[model samples]
Structure formats: C-alpha cells, structure tokens
Target chain A: MTTAPLGQLPGQTRRGERILIGLAVGLTLLFIAAPLVFIFVRAFAQGWQVYAANILHPATLHAIWLTTITAIIVVPLNVGFGIAAAWAVAKHRFPGRGILVTLIEIPFSISPIIAGICYLLLYGRQGLLGPWLQANDIQVVFALPGIVLVTMFVTAPFVAREVLPLMQAQGSEQEQAAVTLGANGWQIFTRVTLPNIKWALLYGAVLCTARAVGEFGGVSVVSGNIRGQTNTLPLHVELLFNDLNAVGAFAAASTLTLIAVVALVIKAILEGRRQS
Target chain B: MTAAATHTGAPIRAKRVLPGFTLSLGTTLLYMTFIVLIPVITLILKGAEIGPERFWRIISSPRAVAAFQITLTAALIATAFNAIYGLLMAWVLVRYEFRGKRILDALMDVPFALPTAVAGLSLTALFSANGWFGPVLDAMGIQVVYTIWGIALAMAFTSVPFVVRTVQPVLEDMDPALEQAALTLGARPWAIFTRVVFPAILPAWLAGCTTAFARSLGEFGAIVFIAGNLPFRTEIAALLAYIRLEEFDYNGAAAIALVLLAFALVLLVVSNVLQAWASRHREASR
Candidate 1:
C-alpha cells in the first residue's frame, strides 16, 4: 500500500495549510540558526581588528595545532579498527556476535565524561595499570596518549557503523568471486572490498574527525585543561571565556565553527549524493 | 585463487589457509572486551565495593536525589519538545520545496558541528541577565540561564537532530500512494495522519526520542555552562557525578554513574521492545 496520503483541505482552507507549513519551516530555521548568527554578530561587533588579533593569538594557534595533531592520530586509528570490526561483524557469523555489536555501541550510550573516568580507572595513578605504567614513566592521563585514547573510545563506532550495514547489504559475493579468481585475502580487501567501502569510510572519517576536534567532556577529565599545553581548541575556547576574554573566545570558537561548518557541508553533499 | 598462488611463491604458503574468520573474530572480541566491557564492569565492581547501604545512601542524598529529579524532568521536557519540533523539521525537509531550503537543511546540523561548550557559552550569553534574551525575560521576572529551563533549552538544541535524522529516512521511504488512497477514501488530513502515516513512522520516532532522551540525560558540557550548577535546584545527575569526582568522592561518583547507567539500560530495553513490536505490527498489516 502506497502511504502518501497527502493532506486534504477544502478550497476555503487551502491557505491555512500553506501558513502552517510556512510557520513550521520558519520556526525551525529560526531556532537552528539563531545561535550561529549570535556568534558571528558577537565576533564582528567588537571590530575586525580585535577579531583578527584574537584569531591569530599564539595560544589559539597552538590549540588548533594540537587539535589537528589529535585528529591526525585519531582518524587513522579509528579507520583501521573500523574496517577490521566492520569486516568481522558484517561477514562472519561468530559466537557472541550479538553481544559484540552491543558492546561496540556502548560508547555511544555512555557519557563521554564516564568514558574519561574509565580510562582514569584503568590507567590513572591509582588505576589497575597505574603501577606498571608509572614504573615505566608512562603517563596516560593528563597526556597526549590519554587524549587520543578517549577520542578513539568516543569515535570507535563511526566508521564501523557506516561500513557495517553497507557490507551487510552488499554481502560477500564480490569477495567470493575474487577468491574463485585466485585473489588472496589482502588483494581482495585492498582491491575489491576497500573500493566498495571507500565513500562510507570517508563519510565516517569526516564525522569522526569533526567529533574528535569538538570533543570536550572526555578530554577535559584527562587533559587536566593545562592551557598552552594539553588544552585543545574546545578547552581553549572555554578557558578564554572563563578568563573573561569573551572576544577571544568568540574568535576561536568562530574559527572552529567555520571548520565544522565546512565538514558538515561536505558530509551533507556526500549524503545527498548517496541518497540520489 | 590464481592471485594467491602467484603472490605466494612458495608452494607450501599457497597450500596454507590463513584462518580469516577465526583470526578476525578473535581480534574483534578481544578488542571490545579490553576497551569497552572491562571499564564498564570496573564501574559496577567499584559500586559493589561500597556495599548496598552505603550505595543507597550515596545515591539517595538530598543533593543526589534532587539532581536526578531535575535531570529526568528536564530531559523529558526537552525530548518531548524535540519530538514535535524534530518531526516537523524532518517533515518539511523531506516533503517541501521552498527558497533557502538547502541552507535551512544544513543549519539542522549546526548543533552537531558546534562544540557543546561553545553552544553552552553562546546560549548563556544570549540568555543571561544582561544579555539579549535575558533582558526581555527579566522584564517579565522570568529567568532562563542557570535555571532548569536553560538546561532543557541547551539539551533541546543538541538533540534536535537525532529525531529528525532518524525519522527523515523512514518518511522518505514511505509510499505516497497510501496517503493518496486514504485521501480518495474521504479520510480527513488528521485522520489519515493518525491512522496511516503515523503508524509507519511511529517506531522510528520513538527510537529517535529514546536516543534524544538518553543523550539529554547524560549531557553535561552544554548544560554545565548555562545551568548555574546550583546544588539542590539546577544540578543534574551527570554534573553531580562530576562534582563527586572533583571532591575526591570516588564511591559517590560511581554510585551516581550506576544510577545513570541503570536508567539508560531501562530506556534501551524499552526502545528495543517498542521497535520489535512496531515491526511486527507493520508486518501483520502488510
């Protein structure tokens, strides 16, 4: 049964439906766009020179540098793991597959703050691995490694979530065909499976990258928020805001917002293409 | 395969199988166990260490109890609001054609793109006493920033996309002819919606709301900035968990975390059941 029951209105009431649709569209746009507009207004209202200065500050530069480095490390790690997990879960019918799928999604449900605490419990000074790590002078918490780990934890499911369903829907026919044609596993994966999943992988990576750059709660607990050292862009934005430098905060935030907007535009374009 | 035979020069290597399924599944299980399960299990174990009486006392303290109530209430309010707004937004985007529609669609993802802290700060600035909306509301003797209302607003901003994204696909997939058939049969718009379109999309809508509610319950960064963080009045459970951690109260933190976890589990179970039932109903109707 085709379910396109269009709204029916008498000729006298047709105008009312248009008004209702207009109001719904208008309200949603206003709610979604207001904050973004507010940021730009605040940023520019204080003169362009102040905005430029704030954006070009050494600390701001450092925060962006740190965030970029973290993303570089995070995106690749997640992509590799996402591929592996997606490959296993989508193709293999192993015992505990259901449980594993649920476990993979636990990070999505658990708060990022709690994820930070988990890392602390596992590798903090008093944690289970703390003694061993301490003996080797390995600092996981309040360090780059800790930041990367938490980011990985939070973004683990992205690529897997993207690729799994695609793989499931497409099935193992291509791989089987390749196998019969004398292609080895690695060759099939690199040449066959990889090509099919490349777009989904890219989409997932874009999302993971955006999330990693904006990650705060988990990183906040582990980074110790040490300004000019461990503080990421998001943390830096908060730091500047707390220090009462609202202009600087807005400037830095606007830049991050710009990056995010660009990423989102790309995601939307890709998704639109995928839909078409 | 010939490629495998050629790649492995050694005859013995060609004859050997790599145990792909076994190796990959083993690695995946080991990774999940080490990364996700162990940490959650540790939290449960730590909570158990505090003993039942102590755990109950910690979680039942006036501050903790108040925080839970406020968090739940605000989350429910936020989720309910988003359910209506998100559904409308999704419906418009999927069904309508208008000027600036593309930009409007892109704006829906702004919440996802922007940092929670930044979103929180913007809202605080916009709604504080001397700020934009703050002055307007102040004239009416109504406060938003640092109140439960602020918390709910922050949550609604972040969660608007969840329901929209979830329901949009289902709505797009729905066949238009069904609605046309209902219209031809003299069903009113409202009747058609409730009887036909609603049932098809209700499952996705509920799933989206569940996700949005869970997200709002756990939300801290955005709410923290605008919530004023008043202990008994505006403090949320997740924020309380943070406070306990700050105070070096590990047991208390674990207790609060356990409570949040329990609620999340319950919601997940309910959502799963609803999804299953809805799918079965759809199949039977078909």
Candidate 2:
C-alpha cells in the first residue's frame, strides 16, 4: 500500500520519495521564505501609522535619495563598461583575450568590504593620495564620491558578465555581413549588435541597479554612515536598528525588500524571455 | 599579383570588419584599470608600506587569527549545509513536476536579489530574544542571534543560492536515459544516484560549493546584524578590518584586508581551474 509503482515505474516517484521531496521543499521555503515574509510583517506590526512615520522620517528620506543617486550614477556607468568589455572580449579575438575576460570578472570574486577599504586607502585622509586630496579640498572618502566609486567597483562586472556569453554565442556573422553591406561602425553596432544583445544588456542593468541600491558593506566603510548626510537606504536601516528604533529599521528594510521583489520579477521575466 | 594587391591595399579588410576594437578595448581596459585594478594595487602598495615584520605581526595577532578562524569555520559549516540542502533543492526542482514548482524555481533567486542588510535584519528579528523563532529557541536554550551560529546562518542564507543555481542546469541537462539504464540493471535508487548521477554533477557541485564558501567568507552586511560583532568571538575578518580602519589603524586593516583578498583570489583561481577540468572531462567522456 505504501509503495505504489503502479503503471509508471520510471516516471512515477515512490511515496516515500515524494515525502522526502516534500520535506526538502518545505524546509527550503521555511529557511528562505520565512525571513522575507518576516521583514514586512514586522514593519507593519504596529499598524500603518508607525510604518508611515518611520518610512517618512527626514533621515530615511535622505537615505532614499542618496541610495537612488548612487544607483543612478553607478548602474549606467557599469552598463557602459559591461557593453564595452563584452564587445571587446566577445566579438574580437586578440592576445591576452582570456586574461582580459578574466580581469573583467575579478570584481565578481572580490569582496565589497575590501573594495571599500581599498578606496579608503586610496582616497581617505590618510590614504596614498589623501594628503594631496586634502590639500586640494576634494573629499573622496567619507563622502559621496567615495560611495559612488566603491559602488561602481562592487558592481563593475554585472553587465559584462551577463552580456559576454550572449555576444560570444551570437558571433560576428551579422557584423561581417553588415560590413559587406557598407554599414559604418556605429551604424552596424546600433543596427545589428545592439538589437541582439538588448535583453541581456537590460538584464545586466537590472542586476546592476539591484546591487547598487542594496550595497551596504563597501558603502558603509566609506560613507561614514553620518545619518542623513552619508547613509544610503541600507546604511539607514543599519543606523535605525543601531538607534534601537526597531519599527523604523524594519520599515526601511521593507522599502529595500520591495525594490528587491520588483527586481526579481523583472529578472524572472527576462530569464523566461532569454530561454524562449 | 592579385593576392599581393589584395593583401597590401584592400579597402575592406577582414581584420577591420569590426572597427572600434581599439577604442572599445581601450576604454574597457582603462575603466577596469582605474576602477578595479588600481584600487587593489593601492591596497597592496599600502600593505607593502607596512614593513613585512609588522605586517606579519598584525595579521598573526591573536584577534586577527581568531577572526580568520571564525570566518573560515563558519563559511565551511555553511557551505557544508548548502551542499546537502542546495543539492536536494536542485534535485527536487529538476526531477519533479509538482504544484507551485515554477514559483519555487523563481523563488530560488530571492536571495540573489534581496539586500544582505535586509536579510540580516529579518533573520536577526526572527531569531532574537523577542522574535518569532526566539521564543521557541529560548525554551530550548539555543541562541542564534549574537553568536557564531547566527554568522553561519546568515552566510548560509546569502550563499545557498549559488549551489542551487550552479547545480540545477547541470542536473536538468543530464540525459535521463542514463538513470533509466542504471535502474534497468537492478540498481537501487541510492546506488544509481551515487554511482551515476553524482559523478556527472560532482565537478559543478564542487565549483558551486567553493563559490558559496568564498562568498560566505566575505559576507559582511548580513552577518554583522546576526553575529553581534564581538571581537575574537563572533567577529568576522571583514568586520574586524572595518574596525581597524575605524580606529585609524590603517596598517592593521590593510594587512587583514590583504589576507582576505588573498583567500578570495585563490578560491576564484581554484574555481576557474575546476570548471576548466570539468569541461575537459565532459568533452573527453563524450
């Protein structure tokens, strides 16, 4: 009764096997799903007023602005880098091509905290160029420029990594044809290659934006976390939590959670499109 | 004569077919050098400035060594769990057709998209004394928040997706006919899995686990919330580096940071090598 192979021996999983699969699924959902649900639940635990108040706080709004500005600046720059790197590495073969491709991926493996530390060393008051920067009245560390730079460093590889394989797979056939047809460089790229890799490019941009907005470790190191002045939304969440404002912290966290959800939705759609 | 003329002065050369090579490659190289490469060089230079003896002492300091120990141990524990859990998740995903399966598959990327800070906050909230799991765990005398377990938990949450994502495609592409043949040969499910399926997926799975381990080692935002950041106890290397920077001990911070960077760089090299070997093995077998 317990083990029913029935008519489908190869395809049909046994009951015990089914139970094991079910438990795996359940545990995964619990471990992964529960934390996501808990954030929003805690945010609204004290009803709408508390949630609204925390979210609308002046410092929170500033953090939101800083986070948005950082993403706005970093994502497009990384997108440009991604496209350029992908094109150079994928379309044309040259000496050190493999090294170039590998170098492009270096950021993916590097830790963001170390990235933040690197910038601090390069631009901080005590850094290699710190004295020069100080003498020149330019602030890189503990300021907006430092935050943007580190964010750029952390997110440098997203677009290139996403786009390279697609470009490589597509090859240079269309490009060669377009050249035969008398298309100029920009025209061929705009007309032929751009259309092909647009989806992957968008996928990379979305991912870049997600990381840019959510970046905490690197930004935290350089941003000085000076409340409204330097805190991005993630840093703001940390600040609020550290301030013992649990509700405020969760509310801020909910906003990021919302962004992450939207990004995931777009990602899922793009992935479906990529497959089909 | 025609070949010489074509080679000498053809207006449309094959090499020139895709123009902007120099321009694009130049920009890419420049950007990478400025953003990624230069910063790392500067860190190394800074580390170099600290005499070797002092640098050695800084990294080998009791606090520094403990942080590395905690980080490596926690990362290993988390990766071990992900190895089992992630493989099970991928297997369920690829082999089974069930209700909410697509949703489950889509949900696999939630960790990748979710902010680590947000993840840490929620996990900490759930496991803290007054949080959801807190009450249950309190009764059982188990503490997650502000402990090494919490550090491992956060790392596990953030890095689990690496294994699942890596293993899923490999499992999906596997020829089901192999499994069928194994079954027909009087092989039990366990034997078939261990002998047939495991071998094929081992390389990819190992790569995934290595990536997860490397990622967990560098994780900062998530672990800080749950880890309690106590020195020599729950403090991770990354956090300790940040603390050193905070205290204006640049050499100490740089030395610690270099050690972490070295670990990440080595793991990445190992991972690339493993992938190459895996592909070569696959090709030879084919």
Candidate 3:
C-alpha cells in the first residue's frame, strides 16, 4: 500500500502517475513551502545580529510570553472539556447527542472575528452584561480575559473532535468489561478508557495548543493590541508589520512558524503510529 | 433502570450505566453554553433588536453590499481552486508513489498549523513589489498583493488541507474490485473514473468543498494583510464587522455578523449532511 499502485487504474500509466506526483509536489513547494521559507528569509534578511536583536526585543518577548500563557491556560481547559464531551458523546447514548455534536462544531464554522463580536455582544461595555460588569468594575473585552476567552472559544472543538472518533471507533466495550468486573466508574475510566485514548488525547492537545497560541482574529478584535501588555505573537506580528518592521515582524513570526512546524512533525509521527 | 433515560434509545441506554454520563454531559452543556451558546444567543438577540427592516437597511448599505460581493466572489474562486487542487492531491497521494510523498503529505497541513497572520504576512511580503514572486509576475503585468486575487490566494492557502484531508481517506478506502470490474468490461480509464470512482467520492468531495467555502467566507486574519482592506473592494465581511466594532457601530456590526453567522450555520449543516451521505454511500457501495 505504501508503494505506488500504478497500472491498477485504467488511466494511470507510469507516465501519468509521475506527472501527477510532480504536479502535486511542485505546486505544494511553490504555494505552501515557499511562504514558510520566506518567513525565515525575511526574518534573517538582515543577518543574525538583526534577527537576534529582533527576537530579543521587548515587544517580541512580551508577545511570546503572552502567547505562551494563553496556550498554557486554553489547552488544559480544552482538554478537560474535550475529555468530558468525548465521554458524553462517544461512550453513551443520549437524547440530544446530535445537537451536542453540532454545537461542539459551531465554532469551527464561524469566523473568529464573529466570535469576538459575539463576546462583545455579551460582555462589552454596551453589551448584555455591560451594566452589571460596569457596576462590578470588571473589564472583559479588550483585555487579557477577553483574549483568553476568545481563544478558548475558537479552539474549543479541536480536542473533542480528535478524541471522539477514536473513542467511538474503540467503543465502550472495555469500560463495559471493567464494570462487569466490579470496577467503579472512576476506576473504569482511569484504568481502561484513559489508557486507550492517551495518544489521541495527546494529538488533540497538540492541535489545541497550536491553535490557542496562534489565534488572532478574535483576539485582535477583543485584545485592543496593547503593546507590552495584551498583544499575543500573532497580533504582535501584525503590529510589527504595520510599524514597517517587516524584518521584526517576520522574526516574531519565525517563532510561531517553528512551533507550527514542530506541531506538524509531532502530528505526522503520531499518525504514522496510528496507521501502523 | 431509569425508564426516562432509556425511553428514547431504549435498548442501548438501558444497559450502560456509564459512570460519567450525567457529569460529562452536564459539563459539556454548561461549558458550551457559557463559552459559545450564550454569546451566540446574545448576538442573535442583538441582531433581532434591530428589527428586520433596520437589519436589512444596515446590511444592504452600499459598502456592506460591496463587501459581501467581493467576499463571495473571492471565496468562490478560492473554493474552486481548492476543489481541483485538493482532488488532485488526494488522487495523486493515494494512487501514486513517489519520493517525498510522505513529506509532501505532511506539508499539506502546514497551512493548518501555521498561524493565519504569519501566512498573511509571508504571502503579503512574497507578493509585494519586491518579494520573491512579485517581480517575476510584475514583468508579466500581473499583480497579486492588495487585490482580490491576493484575498483568494490567502483563503485558498488557509483552507488547503480541508479538501485533501477529507477526500484522502475516502479515496484510500475505495474498493479496487469496482474499478477492476469496470476494466474487465472494457471501459476506458476515464470511463472507469467517471462512472465508478467519481460517483463513489462525490459526496466527500462536495462535503470538502462546502467546508472550504464556509472557511473562506469566514477567513479574516490571513486575508486582511494581502487584501489591503480597501472599502468596496477587498474588505471581507468578517473584516467589515470588525471595522464596525472598532468604529463603535455596534448595531451595524451585529447586523452584518448575523448574516455571516447564518451562512456558517447553513454550511455546517450541509457539510454534516454530506459527511453522512458520504459514509452511507461508502457502506452501501462497499
């Protein structure tokens, strides 16, 4: 299966297969790989000293820190909800199962900017909870809370989607077996379910982390892009780019690009394991 | 045995007294409500508060209409390109073996993993008058950056994986027997594909296109950089909503956002239906 199954198809001659492979590879390199390479090229276009300085700049550090903090918080919350949702949907039959699954996927289809707008409609100064929040002197939108909440919203489905399929495919047979063996619910989940899903859980976590760190549109609308404060890496890249610091922007971007690459590598390796 | 809990799905729910069902479902509903459902509810309410007439007026404003037109046009173009490119990638990846195929397969997800803002920045820089591909195209009188083409390119870039990923599994799982029968019947390769293989993968391809189109409609971060955000030109609906928010025109923003939300919801349902149809199609055919 790993090798070419050429000549299996009526139209797929050796030449045709080569042509398609060349086209896929060439177009991918041009359209996909080139931009990734360009990020580093522009980042170090001025050489290591400038790239190093840009990477070490106060703005860059703050952005990285903020993005890291956001991911650190969002990833775990997503994982918790992910596990819970997967348990609910994949392991048991329920009345509103279809609706819950649909609701879980809503954020994926909605624009992140619209998600921010949704929050603004609920929690902004002139929003649904505006007067109450004002009375309490609490700031949600245009702040760190807003950034974290929106990131959570945008990435909420990643972990659940990943783990649910695995759980559904594996089914609850093991858990049912544990129960027949007189294992309690907690014991069953911990001893049987968790062990089976650990890889998918990690896969989901990796995707969630990647998304939480890179979230921008919603964060931008809600963050107010305060330098040395609320700007995450993605926002900061925009800020630096707008400031005419293309080099610095790409320098900041290179970090995220590296994270993305690492995440993909991990995902690919995990996928290989699953297939094997 | 709780009769009510088991009433709807009587057979299965009766047997599995799973430990975490209530607690897990409760957590999922509560979290979804606070984080997603409630905010969305408020947005719909806000949109409703404007009344249909006002909402219509707001969205039909000349600039708003233009943004919708541009976004739709660009998203359509992006979806079309991805449809072809995705099918090609899936077909090649599944049918052919080549050096670096795995690497290329892995690379398909770069757009997914890469931050949209970075993609936008890199694309903008690369297509600007001085960046890598700019001059070569410029000499041919082709300009990409700050145009609808740029917007479509960015959208296509961000959504590249959707189609390939969706269609790949379907293609891989396709039964060889059907094609073999077609070949034994003296069908040409094109006929085999069109009559046999293509029917098998149609639902999945359509499902992928629906999602890619939905994604293109909502795309923001990646497009803003390359599109130049010119009013009545490249400004997408999402960006327009953001602009209204920035201007403190909450009513206007809410009105426009409601439209985009509607599009998303409809597309989500359509995609789900297509996914179901695809699986059923596979089961029946297999």
- Candidate 2: TM-score? 0.96
* lDDT at residue A90 of model 2 (Cα atoms): 84
After superposition on all CA atoms, what RMSD does each candidate show versus the true structure? 4.3, 3.0, 3.0
Clashes of 1: 14
Cα displacement (Å) at residue A257, model 3: 0.4
The candidate maximizing DockQ is: 3
What value does the interface RMSD of model 2 take? Answer: 3.1
Consecutive 10-residue window with the lowest summed lDDT within model 2 chain A:
A1-10
lDDT digits (tens) for residues A1-276 of candidate 3? 223243475334567777778888889998999999999999999999999999999979989999998888899999999999999999888687888898898899999989999998888999999999999999998788899999999999999999999999998867866765678878988899998898899999999998899998999988988888989999999999999999999999999999999999999889888888
Instruction: Please give, for residues B197-269, the per-residue lDDT of candidate 2 as tens digits.
Output: 8998888899899999999999999998999899989999999999999999999999999999999999999
Chain A TM-score for each candidate, in the given order? 0.92, 0.95, 0.95
Would you list the rank order by lDDT, best first? Answer: 3, 2, 1
**Candidate 3 displacement at residue A58 in angstroms:** 0.9
Worst window of 10 by summed lDDT in candidate 1 chain B: B11-20
Candidate 3 colliding pairs: none
